[model samples]
Target: MSGTARTIEFDQPGGPEVLQWRTRPLAAPQAGEVLIEQSAIGVNYIDIQHRSGRYPIASFPSSLGIEASGHVLAVGDGVSDFRVGDRVAYIHLPIGAYTTHRILPAARVVPVPEGVPLDWAGVTLNRALTAQYLVNDSFPVGPAHVVLVHAAAGGVGQLLAQWATHRGARVIGTVGSAEKIALARAAGCHEVLISSDPGWVAACRALTAGEGVHAVFDGIGGAMFEQSLLALRPNGVLASYGTPAGPIPPFDIFRLNQLGSLHITSPSIFTFNKTTEALRARSADVFAQALAGVLRTDTPRLYGFDQAREAHADLAARRTTGSIGLSAR
Candidate 1:
């Protein structure tokens, strides 16, 4: 391992501009930990939220990021699942991935299989794994179910649409404008509608022949939360997984009651894969699908490690498609 690595850290939380590189000393792995030489570092809205202080957990001179793909450079005591030179990808809390090297718990790391590229594996986890739980377990989508996914053109949204379609469920998707309609449709949205359509909700109702959808998988958590509720059938589920349009403002709990006795949940991927065994299994499942070509992220948007700020800006502007990551070099 190198004596020092180029790392990104900021004393205060704010915009992407707050991120800058510094030569930080690299430490060896501790027990059950593996020191990784990072290759593809990922950037997501969650990283933006952390960088902007929306969650406010980072301390002075703090690090940020939790997704990346790399090769194990060293293994500390008790780490038997990995050895030097094994390619792996990992995601976890307490950020440290905005760097060329990282040290993380072996339990949180999973091997990258033969067919999936390291960059693809790096960008796939946050979206693919989230999609996995959303379809397979969150509300247990099936053939008979009709669902709506907000921001359907997004990496996660596309994956959700693709997987839900494969499950025999009919997928309806929401996008901000007409230009994105085709993108969503390509991702398996049986029908796509502009969220701004005067009768978008009515359109959903009409699409389902007034029966409404079985569930609404929403990541644009804010106004979309309420709109999503409207698109669901009685006893429908609304999974509020993100807040790109800003955090959902406080609202009445009885709103659900008023809206057809609906069920709403804001589940996190972390909670879904809390157990090491569960994480490994879910990771493997998503990885297998990627290798099988069921999930599409053929060419990820590439960014230099120093261009982190630009990357965040592009994401915040909604100008990105497919998986996006920073190259360690």
Candidate 2:
């Protein structure tokens, strides 16, 4: 595996158009690494952030992407965990998954389980793992809990809603528009509210019998910070994980006390799955859920490597729903 890899890279952060194709020489896997011929790459909001300079890259001429699914082409020395031709998926650092071929640390890659499609794994692995931590660790939804999931029609949102519902929690989801209400409901939301409506927070509280929800899984960021707080009950937890709308602005900590001793904390998948053992365990849980039909395995909207710009544009505009992936084939 020592040839050219067709990759999507950017010389300077700007817009989707900044993403361009480049054929770079692919090197053999180093010790503790694995060469992968990626089949599908996930398109996440973070990728947009990296491309738009909201999240700065280390330098110019950077490749953008963090998650993908593919087959192992070669394994370096001392790597017995994976063999050539094994299906694998990874979501980790170094920001270079948007290519036809890549070399990644063996520790960062996980095997895609039987019955899981590589494309689905490519687009949903990161999100599903995020949902895993959010549901099982960050807030720990349970049978007696009532939870609110923002962007319920989105990828992580759908998975979160489904997982929470599977855990027997009463799930209320918020979508940007009415068109997505059905999709949210299909993902196991007991109630769906339009986030655009100013009274959505009130509606959520009303559904919870004026007590507010036990937890709020908010990814919309800044714009919805106060609203998310308002949607929580006394001593409720707010898991602020993403900033797709924009980074959350500084706010008063005392506001939590005023809001019935509410708790606000941000959690990251990287932090939750920091160790190799933790990463594999979490990935196994996600795959088990996927195989058990707890998480839907619907086909995601896919764009070719050449259409990376369009994919970013659509994602930034919030024009697509569920998961979307870049086809590396």
Candidate 3:
């Protein structure tokens, strides 16, 4: 492994301008860790939230990536199940996914299958694993269910839509622009609506025969959180996983009782991957799904490591669709 690598660091929390691409020293693996020469880094909306101080756990001068996939260069003491030359990918809290090389806990890194491409491995874990839990555990979907996914063209949205459809559930999706409608529809949304339009919720109710869906997956919190409640059937779930529109407004818990006994839940990847065994079990399911052709790894928008700021800007402005990647050059 090279003694030095390039990483994006920030001194203070702000907009995309805060990110700096510079050469930094690569860290050697400590006990029970491994140094991965990164291949593709996943750029997520949560990264933007962390950089802007909305989610303030990140300290200054921090490396800014949540997950990546690459080849293992060195293994620290007592490391097993992984070796010096294994292709692996990992995701977790303690950010540092955005670099040419990274030293991560060996137990968190899972080896990629022979048929799966390395670049795809890096991009799949964070999004795909979340999708896996959302489908399998978070208010499980099946043939009798009708589901609604907000931002249906997003990285997580696409996977959820496809998985729901493959399970014989009718899926409805909402996107911000007209261009995204077709892509969401193609991704398995039986019906797609433009969220920016005033009548989007009305469209949802219409699609469900005015009774609303069995469950509503809402990641674009704020106003959408309330709107999602109106679009849910009695006893339906409103899965609020993100707050991209802004923090949700204060409301009465009785509002849920008033709105057909709706349920609201805010979930994060770290909670699902709380234990190494839990993480491996989820990753194994994701890998199995991808290998079985339920999830597509191709079509990710790849960007270079130096273009990190531009990548964030594009994501924040919704200028790009599907997944965005940072290639370690």
Candidate 4:
């Protein structure tokens, strides 16, 4: 609180090399906001999208972290639920989590349970909330349903697989490598396959006895989006979340009719937690599951705050797995 906070920022839109570390005097939180000294920061794929200009931003010269965990240093007027020294984490925010200290809306921060590690809180809230909505809202998965998740070993992938399994759904996953298959299986996937394999869709059909899955979670868009449609049975749902391979090409509505009257929706965390009540409910489910051990977060890879650039590069290159956290001061 005595000195300026340092953060990584990019003045021009480009690759990881554009991120630079700089310092600025820390400011007190405004009304309904709280100032936190971050203990850990989460590196997500969305950050890569923002950096590569795939996800358009209205402005530049911004810091780049969607979520993090830390203790409250001070609370502004009218804030009551949190106090100084409270452990908390949040998601769906503008650029700025890539710093040692920040001021965020008080409503966004949720008190974390003692059982959840600080670094785990940093990475879990966003991805876990996503899984919560996907399973509970976008499509209600149940014991009788068969769910297929793309990028099963990735952050959201692992969480979705675990949660779907808890709901009694037969959770299957698609990964890029054999090692990732083991990781996905450990995360409660009933079956795991390589997404790039030529016969992967056939394998999915074989698993369901030619019936296909009840739902397909399509994160790798582009041509894979069409393939996901083919892997669904009648009245199946297709949740196309991320476009790591780039956005899917425009298609006709009749394509859904052709593909068993399947339903497709693209969801973002911002729309899921649009209200304070929604945020409370979503974060509560996330922390409760983490506390009860219903969903196990894999050991996160640690990168020093200064190594943020390297972390981004690794994440974009697909050399990193699970969550990547930056240790804050």
Q: Which sequence of candidate numbers ranks them by lDDT, best first?
A: 2, 1, 4, 3
- Candidate 2 TM-score to native: 0.99
lDDT of every model, 2 decimals: 0.88, 0.93, 0.86, 0.87
Taking the tens digit of each residue's C-alpha lDDT, what string does model 1 give over 1-329?
A: 45999998888888888898899888989999999999988888898998888878746788878899999999999999999999899888988789998999999999998888889888668888999999887789999999998888887888999889888899999988788889899989999989878789999999999989999999998777778888999999998999999878888999889888999889899998899999999999998887777787576777998999999999899888656888886
Candidate with best TM-score: 2
Query: Candidate 4's residue-wise lDDT over 215-296, tens digit each?
Result: 9888778899988999999999999988888888989999989878889999888898988888988888888988777888
- Candidate 2's displacement at residue 290, Å, is 0.3
Scored against the true structure, residue 91 in model 2 reaches a CA lDDT of 96
Clashes of each: 0, 0, 1, 0
Go through the candidates in order and give the C-alpha RMSD of each one to the true structure: 1.3, 0.8, 1.2, 1.2
Better structure of 1 and 4 per lDDT: 1
Please identify model 4 stretches exceeding 4 Å from their true place.
Answer: none
**What is the TM-score of each predicted model, taking all chains together?**
0.97, 0.99, 0.97, 0.97
Among all candidates shown, the one with the greatest lDDT: 2
Comparing 2 and 4 on TM-score, the stronger one: 2
Residue pairs whose backbone atoms clash in candidate 4:
none
